[model samples]
Target: MGPWQLSVSALAQPDKISHLPLRWIRGSRAVMAFTVSVFLSSILSVITAANPPYPPSTVIRKIVWAPVDTITRKAAGSDNLPVTWADDEAIYTTWGDGWGFEPRVPNKLSMGFARIVGAPGNFTGTNIRSPAEQLGGGRSGRKGWGIISVDGVLYLLMGHADRQGGQAQLAWSHDHARTWTFANWKFLQFGLMGFVNYGKDYKGARDNYIYSYSHDGPLADTPADRFILMRVPKNRITERGSWEFFERIDETGHAVWTSDSKRRGAVFYHTDGCLRSAMTYNAPLHRYLWWQQIPVPKGSADRGDTRFEGGFAVYDAPEPWGPWSTAFYTERWDVGPGEHGDFPAKWMSEDGREIYLVFSGNDSFSVRKATLVLAQKY
Candidate 1:
């Protein structure tokens, strides 16, 4: 809770260690002194292998900043606009730094790529590549973003992050992650709105198409849970008017789909909305893994003035949009006294069992390694 008060060493739960062999336990404690992140990750790796009665959980390890953060020295300038997606050889992400959602900031948002120096499959050694630079896609602003790679092509699903009154744009990159085609005439529509704010949750090449989701609300509003689902044919996303919206089955037990975007209802609904979320297709568990920030309630309505505050929660579903169940949650863990905690699905293990939960707020990029266990059926 409260800025940086969360100690990494304390993240280990003794109960979870009870089943470990004594020698292994002793070795893990030895790692407590310095390599907290590594030790926690190793332990959880074993825990997941054990098939614990819960979705894997987390062991927060450390706090870090994108090397670029050292230069900007300001939260609003760099690494703040977060949307992550990945390819097999590398984990890729694009962010909005010094871009604006307000009139003064410009309608088109500038974007930058998050750089990681290491080679493929070695995710542990990653740190933000210093000195952020603009990418081809960053030339304009977007909201509800998601990215996927197919046959060496990176496709970014971008929508309006502001009230610009635009639809989702598809950006493409060939020649190995160099640059991209920012926007096309085609866009996604749901309930009379085109900029559904997607990139927060997406699954590429599933069910013969690229499945994605969007939420209806402003950025600052958390617990804002109405989500609409959409899909586009693989490799055909650039074609205007080719996208399809999710239509729930009617009470009469018949599947229905209407060309009218206004008639589309939210595929998944929640009482309160989660501000930011990440969606991943976990190969190990064969399920859709989603992580989101549950905002802290405001004022006496909650317990005093607790504003801009939130924590993390992970959910699992049979598909990208439906029948979701909680896999992990830290209701009391505060990534934000004034900020939010999030998951970059691309940074997760292939099995979908573990990931690094990144926290942003008060000018810091803190991270904790987390995972899912099968705990209690949810």
Candidate 2:
């Protein structure tokens, strides 16, 4: 087996010691104990060498949320909001299946781009109609899943070019999302990709790489068994060949990346499953926050109306490819957490305790205030 490969049974079957010749050691319990210890240690080394100690416990005890804030003019009648803070001191975001912001569009747009100005509570959005904007939803047009700004240019991750579960492409705007140039390449295998936000113009990023994540399946609405991660040098995001997929972790707990997509491994696993996520780095707390949507089960009443009501989960980690810990989770949130959500870095408090959550509830853009109760220091 390769160095990165591990047999599940090797760690699972710890009691299978029949292969050891106990007769040689005979009544010497000390020798027997040392022999077994060595055997177990070898197995543990192999396992740790192949994978990180995942699902690490969190420093956040829990998240306490206030009621969803009432919708203001700009946020109403839109959903699928993927946002990024630009260097120009404004938040740029995308909206789907609605006329965006005030003075609304001439007709409903499948996807539209807008720039938000002012603070979170008092901000206003102005639609920036672009020739690149898609006109319809679902099969007819594309869904905007992720957006990021680096060095004054804005990049958008477009999913569902053919279908929601089909393909994703990168489009960028040099003029603050006013005009875009689409990349010719398509992410053929990874259908839905969400960018990891690192504050204004990628300022607080841990490294030079821009990270992204996707669930196991192609469909964005459907739950997947695991989440996959990928990263590209911040300067080469549009170059298809520069992207690398996460494969595994070495014995040092450092991430191993590969250019080969097929060799990529899972970064996160959820028994209850997860969908597209909103991720941001909290510089004050030095943790990555992942706001993931939990899909309702098939054949259930909630499944048909998840847009209005369903489940949502929040997790935090020390890195983008996480040994994640749950910060908040609920099967039945008071209001539907929508299909998409984001915790814009600009809205976070200096101490990283108070924050605002932007999501689509009742099929409209919504905002809610939340407080983080951190684990007490020893």
Candidate 3:
């Protein structure tokens, strides 16, 4: 089917009430209104109960302008980087073709590095790798790109291309950055080049669940394709993993997944190309979904361009898969000097409290921390 064909007719319509009587409708209308209101309220309550929003217990902390030790000062290089804080330390990955400012540099390689910081209060950085060491000799070994942390473990997702083929791989670090377990790195199926992005919701004090997104098939150029959501079981690692596939979009799209901390835990993915995102909570609204097409702000540089950097959406659901409410959609802030290209985003902390947005353009990259504070309603 086409991209916009997600079965959206299931959502209830209140406009149907207009067909009722006009004059005699006062008393009858009051009773009917109460009935409809009660029915709709019941449905909303069920949805909220199934996919509640994140609790206040999940505190959000912001870390900005975190210092970076120059791994390589190439006049022709761009610093399009991605960063994540795990185990009380911050990890960064840089990617780009050696160009403008940093050109003639010999070891023209993209790289990934880790730094162990004491805390947000203690922001001193330590260099984890050097340019000569990161370059190596591969043509497509540009650099590591995607970074995320789950259950105290660090994961890096990146791609490399050679005469053989190009594929994305996953690497894990157990003891922070001191060591890494890069064994059977799961490569993306041939022709697919992207990394898995993740999200989580906390239950009680120490329990929670994580979800990751990845896909297989028609490659980059194809328009009609579906992305798969793999719900990573708590503390388990293996390909015998359980995953579900959402219907394919007729074109490329971007999504942000968040978990609702209720029963079965709901997951909501906001897909861009289709101008809508779908939510998979329980069995009833299981098929029930909600979405809103946020237009690019007028007169902004992103007016006609859907690919503008830094555009992101975070949803609040009373339960997991949701009838979620849009918190806010903001224009891309130039984290980099000029244009910071957008990359996949991840929740820095649980409960949609804080979002870590990563963007890269040309040679420069940056990560911004956004908190979902109560937006002042006019």
**Top-scoring candidate (TM-score):** 2
Q: Cα lDDT of model 1 overall?
A: 0.44
Candidate 3 lowest-lDDT run of ten: 52-61
Our model 2 lands, by Cα RMSD against the true structure, at 9.0
Candidate 2 backbone overlaps, count: 0
Q: Which sections of candidate 3 miss by over 4 Å?
A: 1-80, 91-106, 116-125, 130-139, 142-145, 150-152, 160-166, 183-209, 215-227, 238-358, 365-378
* Candidate 3, 138-205: lDDT as tens digits: 33344454455666776654545331224555556665544555536454452222223332211121
Candidate 2 similarity to native, TM-score:
0.83
lDDT leader = 2
Per-prediction TM-score = 0.58, 0.83, 0.46
Output the worst ten-in-a-row residue range by lDDT, candidate 1.
191-200
Q: Which scores higher on TM-score, 2 or 3? A: 2
What is the total number of backbone clashes in candidate 3?
Answer: 27
Per-residue lDDT value at 245 in model 2: 95
As a whole number from 0 to 100, the lDDT of residue 37 in candidate 3 is: 30
lDDT of 1 by residue, 1-378 (tens): 321233444334433332232222243342231223223434543444222212233221222323322221122333333434444445455444333211123322345444332322233322232222333332134432455655556666554433342345567777334656765364434211211211223343354566666665433232344666666676676765666666754443233455456765554444353345556555555566565555454443432112234455566554564444445555544434223334555555665556555444432333556545453433
- Candidate 2, residue 265: how far the Cα is off, in Å: 0.6
Give the residue spans of candidate 1 off by over 4 A.
1-77, 80-88, 98-110, 117-144, 161-167, 186-205, 217-225, 250-258, 296-308, 330-332, 337-352, 359-366, 376-378
Expressed as tens digits, the lDDT of each residue in 1-378 for candidate 2 is: 332233577554433332232222344442343334334434543454222112223478778888555443355678888888899989899998888888788888888999988776688889998988888666467879999988999999988766644678899999987789999988876666889998888898998999989886665556665788999998899899999999975545567899999999877776435567889998899989998887777666333235688777788877787656557767678877787888999889999998888887777667778889987860
